[model samples]
Structure formats: structure tokens, C-alpha cells
Target: MTIRCAVIGLGMGRGHAKAYSEHKDCQLVAVADIDAARRERAAKEWNCATYTTAEELLEKAKADVVSIATPNALHRPLTLAALASGAHVLCEKPIAMTAAEGREMVAAAKTAGRRLMINLSYRFSPQSQVLKNLVDGGALGKVYAGRTVWLRRRGIPGLGGWFTDKKLSGGGPLIDLGVHRLDLALWLMGHPKSTWVMAGAWNHLGSRIGASQGKSYSVEDLAMAMIRFEDGSMLEVEAGWAANIKEGELMETRLLGTEGGLVQKNVGEGYDFQAEVFQERNGTQLDLSPHGPFPECKSAYHHFVEAIRDGKPHTATGEDGVAVQELLDAIYLSAAEGRPVAMGATTTKTGAGTG
Candidate 1:
């Protein structure tokens, strides 16, 4: 059975539609957008029925699955609607503005007995997967620490659009870009129990670019967080749209483990990536980089379709998304409280002990 899918919210929704169309097990049946022009363009480009609202499409086409690419604030409502209408969902990252909202969405999915996949696109990147394999297979040894960063020089999307608006986008780079790296870090840590978070966020960059058309820049353009785990593991995550760096644009994540290390780095301005795992065996250091056909999106997109067919679980499942959201909430709470926000019990605690 072809999984009939609908793409809602034409911005990122178009990309979802394209991926779904190209998937062998899925069929793009309709497209919907609040903007009629975008909806019309999508309909013309993809040669599918288009509607001004998702409600109209679901009512008419009766979609089996939906990709909710609406803005941050609309994710919950749109996602709930899709699930309520007996459609599985592929929602964009952040899932919802807060952990409570994310939980509600999860409950909705359980109640409807449908699948909901949150698109943390970075987790699906080929380079990231290679690193994950090495790490998970004990090639990276005992991971002690890792650093994941996403920094851009002058890249700010939507200009005066919702991207910069705090109310709409939730919380700048932290909620937008930071969530990706944070998810990657948590995943690399083997989903270790997040003990607490200490975070610092700033609006310096966005505010400095003031008087521009960028929606008054109310959110933090930069966010740096330190996450601790119960397993004695730690991670440092940083994300920013603007910073005082001359490296043009830097997007990478490195894991330093006791047995070895794994690093995924971007090549200059290209989205093309490279990954490596380094280890010392018998006093000789070795570096391993896998090779083969690695079309990043093709793998992830098709994986979702195959999971639906084979009744298997996806790496980026709804459960994984909730874990990411909880970590994000802790990070933000830590920043707001100027202290570490605790989530779970730790294996070890730093305290005064009589030796």
C-alpha cells in the first residue's frame, strides 16, 4: 500500500513533499499552505492537489501521513490535527515550544495509535551516521566528552519573518539551530541520562544587527550549553547565527573518548562532510574513515518509508524527539535560573567527601 502523504506549510513542507514523492513506498497526494500563491506553486510544480489550509486537504484527500512544516508555534496544533485525522506525522524539529507541549503531542500519537516522526535532519546526515556507528560499536571507546557546534557568520533566515521573532520561533539559535546539535550530542552519548544543564544564551548578535528588517531580533542569536549525564559523560553544545568568528561558517561535532575519538567536520562552504574515528592500539594510532555511496537524505527519507512497510523502528523516532526536547528545556531552564537544571539521577555526584 502506498502511504498517501500530504505536505502542509509550503516553506519546509515543499522539501518534505519532494522527499516523500521520491520515496518508493510513499506517494505525495496533496499540498497545503496558508499562502495561496505558495500552495499554487507547489501544486503546479509537483502536479498535486493543493489547498489553502491543512484542514481542507485532510477533509478532502484524507491523507494517511502528513509532514507538518509549519512555523514553531503551529507545530503542535497542526501535528495534533494530523494525528486526530488518522494520519501519521513527520514534524520538524523542536517538536513543540516546551516540554509540556511536546508531551501533549506524544500523548496524541499514543491515543491515535499512529506514528509521528520529528525531522531532526542532522541526525540523518551520512557523516553523522558513520560517526554514530563507530561510537556505538565501541570503536570510540568510553566517550568522556564531546563538542557539537553550529555557527554561521551572517546567515539569518526569514529576515523580518518568524525566524527572529521570539514568540514565533520559541528561542532563537537555541530552539532552532541548537536543538539539532543537542540532539546529536545526546544521541552520541548513547542517550545517557541527562543529569543537568548549564546554559548561556545571548541576543548580542541579533540586536547588533538592529534597525534591519529582522523582526526586531528579540531572541537569542547565540546559545552555549554544558550537559552532564549520570554515566559520568559530558557534552558541550554551541549554536549561533552571528558571532565574532572569522572562520566564515563552522559546522562540526567532535567526540573524545578514552579508547579513541570521532569527528565529523564540514568542508569549507560546502554541505559535503567528512568523518573519522581515531584510536591507539598497541601504542600505534589509527584513523578510520568509511567509504561508499552515501546520499544522506536518500537514506533517511527511504528509511522512514521502509520502517512503515516493515514495522521497524526508525533511529529518529518520536521517543528520541521527546528526549531531545527535555534536554532542550533543561538547557533553557538552566540559562534562565543561572544554575544547572536537573533532569535525572546521576551515577556520580560532585560533592565534599571525607577521603
Candidate 2:
């Protein structure tokens, strides 16, 4: 049974299209984008039908699987439409602009009886998978604390465009880049429920650059947060699109547990990553690194298709996306209100200050 796939928004959707086209059990049936040039290019490259809008593609493409890679604000509506159209959806991360929207999307998918997966792409890396296995195997027993960061010296993307616009892209790197590391940390730590968050955000450099370019930028360039979880585990998160850091790009997730500590960090300020495990045995410290013969790392699209076809669990689910969205909301609210935000039956600001 071949799964017919369609992709919306050709920017990151191009990767989706490529993955689906390459997968053995999937066929790239259609693609949609606002840009005529992108649609034409995708059509020529992937040999698929093209549409001007997501609505048109959903109406006529007959796709069994759909990938939503549109702007942040469009995720909820597009995902709802796709689920209603009886297609399993693979949506890009942060789920939606807000946690409420993410919940709604998850509910819609359940009602439609379709799979809704998020493209938390970073988890698909081999290094991450290995570390996840080790953590699950008790290499890191009872993880108590972690620090995850993705900092770019000067890497604000599409500075004046939708990426920098809060309405269109949600917040800045916290949602864009930070979500990846945060999710990785949480996944490795067994996804503890967040209890409260204290965060600070700034847009100093982005706003100045946008003003000088006569463009509107309304999102933070740097965001830092400390989160407490129900399991007594704590996480420190730092995401920056532009900073005075030494590296052009720096990404790392370190977890400290009762038995050992593990770190997955980028190599040479690039996408390539290396992971290490540190433990003390026989009164001697040992540093360990995963070698080859690692499990096959599958792309998010491939995992989504496999989940749909084989009833296997997806690497990232809508619920996971919602969890991340809740943290993001709490972080933003905490930053804006100058206090810690508590998550419970309902979210509320706490009297405790960042002090």
C-alpha cells in the first residue's frame, strides 16, 4: 500500500517532499505554495502536481499523508483542514502559535482518527537516538538537571520577514531553534511535566537592525528560562538568534543524573554533533562516546509514514508538540510579567520573582 503524500509551503516543505519521494512506501503526489516559481520548480523536480493554495491541494490531491510546513500562524488551521480531509499530518514544530491552538489541533486529529505528528527534526539525529537509548537504559539514572542551548552569534533568519514577526512566526529563536534543544532535553529526561518557569527575553539587537533596515521586527532575539518539573527535575534553556557569543552557532544539551552525565554538543559550531557519557567507576572517572553500529536514523517524514503504515509510534507526536508549546507560552508569559509562571489545571502568574 503506497501512501500518497502532499506538501504545503515549499520552503521547508521541500525537505518533506524529498523525504516522501525517496521513501519506498510513499509517493509525492502533490505540492502547494504561494510562489508560482516554487510550485513550478517543485513540479519539475519532483514530477508531482502543484497547487497555488493548501485548500486547493486538500480538495483535489487525494493525499493520504500531508505535510504542513507553513508559517507558525497557519499551522493550526492547515492541520485542522488536513485532518478533516482524512489525511495523516506531519506538521513542523512548535505545533501552533499557542498551546491552546496545539490542543485544538490534537483534538481535531483524534476526532478525525488520523495521525498528527510534529517535525521535531533534531531528535532524528543518530547522536540523539544513541543518547536516548543510553538514557533509557539507565546510563543516566534519574536525571535531575539539564542545560540546553542553541546560540547563534549573528544568525537572525529573515530578519524583516515573517520569521522575525511574532504574529506570523510566533516568537524568535525560542520557538524556532530552542524548541529543538528543549524537546531533546525533555525527551532524554523522560518528558517531565513542567511546573513553573522564570524567563527573560530581549530584542535589542534585532529591533535595532530592523529599524535601521526600515523593517518591522517584534520578536525577541535572546530568551533564557529556568523551568522546574513535577519530578523535581530542572532544566535551563537558552536560545539566541543573535548574541555576543564566540561561536557562529553553538548547540548543546547536557543532562546530569544520579549515576552519570551525558552531553550532546555540536562539533565546530556546525550541525555535526558528538555525544559523550561521563561516569565514575571504581573511584575512576570514565568518559565514553558512542561508536558506529548505531541505530539507523530516520527522517521525521519517514517516521511519520512508517507510523501510519505499520502502526508504529511516531518519534514526535502532537501531544509532545503541545507540551513544548506550553513551556514556550509559560516562558513568554514569565518574561512579560517579570515573574515566574506556574502551570497547573490553568496557567497563572506566581508571586515569585526571578530573584
Candidate 3:
């Protein structure tokens, strides 16, 4: 049983197309992009049919699996259309612009009786998988707190385009880069229910640079937040696209537990990562690191395909995406209101000072 796959939005969708083309149980049937050049290039490179719009691809491709790699605002509509077309979906992350929209997408997938997975790509790293295994196996015994951060010296993407526009891309690094790290930390800690958040955001550098270059930029360049969970656990989150930091790029997630602590951080300002675990053994300090002979961590695309084919559970479900979206919404609201915002309930009474 071969799964026919189609990809929309050729920028990151190209990676989706390549993964499908290489998977043994999948076929890259079609691709779509508004840009004619991108469509033509994808057709030539993948030798697959191309469409001018997602609507046309869904109508004609007859694909069993669809990948939605469009802008943040378009995620809901495109995902609804794909699910309506009877194809399981693998949507790019942040899921949607709002938690409400993410919930709607999840409901639509349920009504359609099709799989809806979000492309949280960071979870597929070998280091991440190993740490996840350790956490699940109780190696980190009752994790209580964590700090997740992703910062770049000067790495604002598409400065004047949809990425910098709040309406199109949701927000800046908090939604783009922070979501990945936040999800990783939460997943490692067994996904505690968040209770409230206090955050602050700034748009100093991005706005100034955009004004000087005669470009429109309306999102914050940096955002920081402290979140509380129902189980008395807490998390500190920080994300920035432009900062005065010396490192060109920095990424790290550290979890503190009753028995031990674990950290996964990028190596040498690059994508390469290293993980370490610290604990006390017989009243002596001991630090452990994962060496060679790690398990195979498949790409998100391949994992989605295998889950659909084998009737197995896949990571990063639509519900997981919504959980992250809820946190994103709360953080932004807290930043805008300059106070702590409570979750789960409708009323937003002040809790702690945003200091």
C-alpha cells in the first residue's frame, strides 16, 4: 500500500517532497506554489506534477498525504482543505496563528478521521530523542523546572516580508524559534498543564533597521517569559532573533529534576548539539554524556508516513501544537498587558509583577 503524497508551498515543502520521494512506502505525486519559478524548479527536480495553487493540487493530485508548509495565516484554511480532500496532513509548526485556530484544525482532523501531525522538527534530533528516552524511563525522576532558550546575534528572517509581519507570521522569535525549544522542554517534563505566564517583549532593533531601510516590520525582536504549571513546576523561556550577544547562534534546554539535571545545547554556535546529565552517585558528583551507538531518529516526514502506514502513534500531534499555541498566546498577551496572565479561566486578574 503506497501512500501518495503532495506538498504545498515549495520553500520548505521541497524538503517534504524530497522525504516523500525517498521513503519506500510513499510517492511524491504533486507539488504546489504560487510562484511559477518555484513550481517549475520543483517539477524539474522531483519529476512530479506541479500546481499553481493548493486548491488545484488538492482537486487533482488525489494524494493520500498532504504537507502544508504555507504561511502562518494560511495554515488553517489550507489544512482544512487538505483534510476535506481525504488526505492526512503534516503541517508546519506553530500549527496556526492562534490557539483557537489550532483547536479548530484538530477538530477538523477528528471529524475527517485523518491524521494531523505538526512538523516540530527539533524533536527529531538524535540528542533530543535520547534525552526523551531517558526522561520517559524515569532517569530524570519528577522533573520540576527547566530553562529553554534560542538566541541569534543577527538572524531576523525575511525582514520585510510575512515573517516580520505579525498578522502573517503570528509573532517573531517567540513563535518561530521559541516554540521549538518550549515544546522540547515540555515534552521532556511530561507535558504539565500551564497555569499562568508573565512575559515582556521588545522591538527596538527590528523597527529601527526596518525604518532605515524603508521596510515594514511590526513584530518584536526579543521575548522572555516565566510560566507556571498546575503541578507546581515552572519554566523560563527566552527567544530572540537579534541581540548584542557574541554568539552568532545559541540554543539550549536544561531540565532540573529531583534526582538529576539534564542539558542539551548547541555546540560552537552551530547546529551540532551535545547533551549531558548531572547527578550524585554515592555522595560523589557524576556527569554523564551520550556517546556513540545512538538509536535512529527518523525525520518528521518519514515518521508521519510510518505512523499512517503501521497504525502507530506519532509524536507532535495537533493537540501538542495547540498546547504550545496556548502558551504563545498567553505569553504575547502577558507582554502586551505588562502583567501576568492566568490560563484555563476566562478572567485575567493580576497575579505577579512583570519584573
Candidate 4:
């Protein structure tokens, strides 16, 4: 039973369309993008119908599911629209501007009786899966700390385009890039309750460089935070577009536990990643790195299809997205308020604090 799917926002939506087309149980029936050239190109490549707007595409495609690779700000409205239009949705990460928005989208999904999956693509990586297995198997006993980094020497995108604009991206690299590692760490740590956060965000890197492209680079180009969990676990997160780093670090997540440790690092400062596991063997230091799989987000694409077909729970649920968003909100608040931000307790009304 092919799950007919539509891909919207053709920048990365093209990849989503191709993944759907390749899946035997899924069919890529249509593509949509506001950019006419991009829309036509994707339609021709995928050999499917195309629309210039998601509303129009949703009206005509009648797909069972839709993959929304739109900008971060558009996530909630588009997901709600798709669910309301009788289609399940797979929206990209950093689900919405606020946890409140994320929760609203989740509620809408429930009201519409539809599935909502956030594309935290890193969680579905084969290396991530294997490391998870080892951790679940107790090879990494009593996980205590994890760290994730997505630094680039000087790789800010869309110049003045939407990437830097807070109106569109909500924040900056923290939401855009760090969110992936945040999800990966929490997922690996069995979703520990985020207790509090101490963080800082800096825009010194991008603005100091020069005038950027179409959008205002008013947000931070770098953000660093420390997250405390209920179980006494901790995660250190660092991400940025432009930073004073010697190495052009792409992405890496490391887990340190009582029994063992696991780390996946970019081998050549790229998507080609290498992972290592450290275990004790009668006092001998053991560092192991098997031939890790290449970069592929298809697993997530396929998961959405099977989830819709089987009516089963999707891997990255709206609740998970909300949790991450809640943490992100806390981080930004911490940076702005110049104090620790409490996650579980802090809210708009309460005089609660995270520090």
C-alpha cells in the first residue's frame, strides 16, 4: 500500500520527495514551492504534479501524508493546515517559535486525529541507532553526561536571507542547528526531565564580519548552554554559523556514561561521520570505530510512511518537539535574563526560575 505523499518547500523538500519516491511503500505524488523555478525543477525531476503554494498543492494532491521542509516559523501553521486538510504531516525540526506553539500544533493533530512527526533526522542515523542499542543493552551503563557541537569556521547561510532573521528562524543557530543534538542527547539519555539551563548567545561572529544578505543577522551566530536533568544527568550544547574555530566542525554528539562512552565525529569536517565506543577491558583503554554508515535521512522518511500506514506511534512525536522547544525557550531566556533558566518550573506567569 503506497502512502501517497507530497513534498512542500522545495529547498530540502526535493530530498524529501526523492526519498518518498524511492520507498516501495510510498509514492511521491506532488511537489510545491513558492519559487517557480524550484517548483518546476522538482516537478520535472520527480515526474509529479506541482503547485506554487502548499494550500493549492494540498487542495489538488489529496496525499495521505506531507513532508513540510518549510522555514521554522511556518511549521505550526502548515502542520495544522495539513492535518486539517485530512493529511498527516512530517514537519522539520525546531517545530515552532515557542513550546506553546508546538503544544497547540500537537493539540490540533489530536483534534484532527492525524499523525505529527518532527524531522529530527539525526536520531534515525544508523550509528545513532547502534549507539542507542548499546546504551539500552547497558554497555553504556548509567549514562551521566553528553555533549553536542555543530560549529562552523565561517558558514552562515542565506546571508540577509531568512536564516538570520529572528522573525523567520525564531532565534539562530541554537534553534537551527543545535536542536538536532539536543534531541539526540535527550533521546539517548531516555528523555530525562530538563531541570534548568545556563546559557549565552553571541552575534559577534556574523555581524562583525560584514553586512550579510537579504535578512537581518540580528540573532546570535553562536550559542552555548549547559542543561541539567532530573536524573543528575547533564548535556553541553554548542552551535553556531560563524565562530573563531580552527577546525570547520560540522556536527558531533558524544555520550559519556558510567560503564562506557560513545562519540560520533565528522571525519573530514563534513557529513562523513566516524563513531567510536570506549569500553573497559581489564584496564585496557579501548577505542572502537566501526565503518559507520553514510549520511542518510531516508530512515526518517520511511518511518513516517510506516507510522501512517500502521497507525503506530512515530519516533519523534510532538511531545518530544515540545520538550526541545521548551528547553530552547529556557536557553534563550537564560541568555537574555543573565541567569539560569529553570525548565520544568518556569512559565509565563509563575515567578519560577531555572538557575
Q: What's each prediction's clash count?
A: 0, 0, 0, 7
**All candidates: CA RMSD in angstroms?**
5.8, 4.9, 5.0, 4.7
RMSD of 1: 5.8
- What's the candidate order when arranged by decreasing TM-score? 2, 3, 4, 1
lDDT of 4 by residue, 146-220 (tens): 998899889887778788788998998899889988888878887877788999998886886646433457779
lDDT of 1 by residue, 12-47 (tens): 777889888887778889998889789878878888
Candidate 1 Cα errors over 4 Å, as ranges: 212-214, 293-298, 344-355
| Residue 301 CA displacement from its true place in model 3, Å | 0.5
**How much lDDT does each candidate structure score?**
0.79, 0.90, 0.90, 0.83
User: Taking the tens digit of each residue's C-alpha lDDT, what string does model 2 give over 1-355?
Assistant: 9999999999999999999999999999999999999999999999999999999999999999999999999999999999999898999987999989998988898788888888889989887888989999999889999999999999989878899999999899999999999989988888887898999999998898889999998999999999999899899999999899899999999999999999999999998999999999999999999998888988889878877788766768888888888999999999999999888675322111111
Question: lDDT score, residue 318, model 2?
Answer: 86
How many clashing residue pairs are found in candidate 2?
Answer: 0
- Model 2: residues >4 Å from true position, as ranges? 346-355
Clashes of 3: 0
User: TM-score for all predictions?
Assistant: 0.92, 0.96, 0.96, 0.93
> Candidate 2: lDDT over CA atoms?
0.90
Query: Better model by TM-score, 2 or 4?
Result: 2
What's model 3's TM-score? 0.96
